[model samples]
Target: MKVRNDAYLKAFGENLKQLMAKSNKNAETVAALGGIETKQVYRVINGEHSATLSIVYAIAKGLEVHPKELFDFTFQE
Candidate 1:
């Protein structure tokens, strides 16, 4: 069975990449701040793997941003 939610992960990954770029932070720095390995960040950024809530929370905290900011939402009328 697929454990990771693909759509959410993909969106999250894209947003994370954008955030990292905007912050001028590399994978190594993000990994250190999130207490994860650099490879994990690479995988997520590449959309090859998904991150758990713990990882997401860590990233948000490390970035000093809210989790909602990591998402791009669209509401239809």
Candidate 2:
């Protein structure tokens, strides 16, 4: 089956990448801070797959931001 990431997921990924860029940290660094795998961070950032709610929260926690902030996206997807 051919499946694609949902619009909201894609939007979240874009927002995550932007936040990561603004954090001035490398993927490895963010992954460590996010308590996730480095490859997973890249996968999410690259939109290879949809991120789970847990991941969303984890990422926000890693960034020292509120989960609501992650949802503050332009929703481009």
Candidate 3:
């Protein structure tokens, strides 16, 4: 299925990518830590889907950062 793209999603995805790079981590690793499927991580990273609150917390845990960090990006909506 094709997921819709929005400014919020795009910003979140970009931040996720940046965090992944800075942490020297991959989708597989994050997924394992977050207890989610690798594809899910990719979906968020690719800006193809929006993550739920739980997923956001999980991703934050995987990234070893606070949940607020993930949302520390500019968005208009």
What digit string (tens of lDDT, one per residue) describes model 3 on residues 1-77? 22334777888999999999999999999989989888989999988878999989889889899999998888666
Q: lDDT scores for all predictions?
A: 0.73, 0.74, 0.88
lDDT of each residue in 1-77, candidate 1, tens digit only: 24345655666678888888888888888888878888888877776777777877767666667877767542222
The TM-score between candidate 3 and the true structure equals: 0.86
Positional deviation of residue 69's Cα in model 1 after best superposition, in angstroms: 1.5
RMSD of each: 3.9, 2.8, 3.4
Candidate 2 per-residue lDDT over residues 1-77, each given as its tens digit: 12334666667778887887887767787778879888887777777767788877777767777889877877542
TM-scores of the models, in the order given: 0.72, 0.75, 0.86
The TM-score, computed over Cα atoms with residue i paired to residue i, of candidate 2 is 0.75
Q: Local error of candidate 1 at 34, Å?
A: 1.3
Q: Which stretches of model 3 miss by more than 4 angstroms?
A: 1-5
- Order the numbered candidates by lDDT, best leading: 3, 2, 1
